[model samples]
Target: MYVVFFYQGLATHLSAKKSALEQLDGYRLRLRKSEEEFHHKEDERHVVAETLKKANAENSVKTAVESDGEEEDEEDADAGSEEDGSRGYTPSPTPAKSRAGSHVSPT
Candidate 1:
């Protein structure tokens, strides 16, 4: 009778150890899944940040182009005014003025 009880107790202890090992395995699997989810979310965030940076750079280039065009137009207008100012007008000589100046001699 004593030997039978000792064997039964040993079997019970082994069964309990097996149940604990199964629970630990389940917890380990859950932790791995959570870590994978965290990495996936981090990758998505990086992609979004890169896209936004590209968009902002494109917008800045477009703004610079538009500003350069406006400056060129202003310069063209100023050059046209300067050209007009440089050309002075001259009056034509009349027939009476030519006849009077023809006989005039300085001594």
Candidate 2:
């Protein structure tokens, strides 16, 4: 009778240990899945950040190019006006004035 009771107790203890191991395995699986999900989200965020950075850089370049084109057009317009003014503004030539720092010796 005593041996039988000992065997029965041992069986109960083994069953409890088995169930505990199963529970531990389930928790570990859940933790692994959550970690994988977290890493995946981080990767997605990194991709989004990189894409936005590229877009901003492209926009900045585009704006810079547009401003440069506008500057060129304004310069062209200014040059055209200067040309027109020069066409009507010929002045009479005057004799050269003597400079105080002149070093020319008469030939």
Candidate 3:
């Protein structure tokens, strides 16, 4: 009877230990899954951030190019106007050439 009781007690203790180990394993698995999810989220955030940065840089370059084109167009228009003005205006005769052999007569 004493031996039987001892054997039963030992069996019960082993069963309890098995249950505790199973619980610990389940907790470890949950922790590992949570860690994997965290890493995935971090990678996604990095990708999004990189994409936004690239888009902003592209937009800035486009804006700079457009502004430069506008400045060039304005300069071209100013040059054209200057050319037109030069072509349309004639210089007046110089005073010395106009009075080369002329004497003023009293009236």
Candidate 4:
């Protein structure tokens, strides 16, 4: 009778250990899945950051080109005005002075 009881107790203890090992395996699988998701998200974030950096660099170059074009236009306008001045083009008088002179009051 004692031998039978000992065998039953041993069986129960082995069964509990097997159940615990299965639970640990389930937890390890979930941990692996979570780690995989985390790595994928990190990779996506890195791609987005790189794309933004490339766009920023392109915009900086575009802005510099536009500024250079504006400077060239301003220089051309200044040169044109200087040419006009050298040709002795007299500026027109203001409308108020012209009207006052046109209406000379007889004193």
C-alpha RMSD (angstroms) for model 2: 6.3
Against the true structure, candidate 1 has what lDDT? 0.88
TM-score-best of 1 and 4: 4
Work out how many backbone clashes candidate 1 has.
Answer: 0
Best by lDDT: 2
| Residue-wise C-alpha lDDT for candidate 4, range 1-107, written one tens digit per residue | 99999999999999999999999999999999999999999999999999999999999999999999999998887778788784434678776645545675799
- In model 1, pairs of residues that clash are none
Better of 2 and 4 by lDDT: 2
Global lDDT of each candidate: 0.88, 0.93, 0.92, 0.91
Off by more than 4 A, model 4: 86-92, 95-107
- Compared with the true structure, model 2 gives a TM-score of 0.73
Per-residue CA lDDT of model 1 for 25-104, tens digit only, reads 99999999999999999999999999999999999999999999999998887777678873333457765655645585
Clash pairs, candidate 3, are none
Candidate with more favorable, higher TM-score: 3 or 4: 4
Instruction: Supply candidate 3's per-residue lDDT for 18.
Output: 100
Global fold similarity of model 4 (TM-score): 0.75
- Candidate 4: residue pairs that collide: none
Residue 51, candidate 4: Cα error in Å is 0.5
What TM-score does model 1 achieve against the real structure?
Answer: 0.67
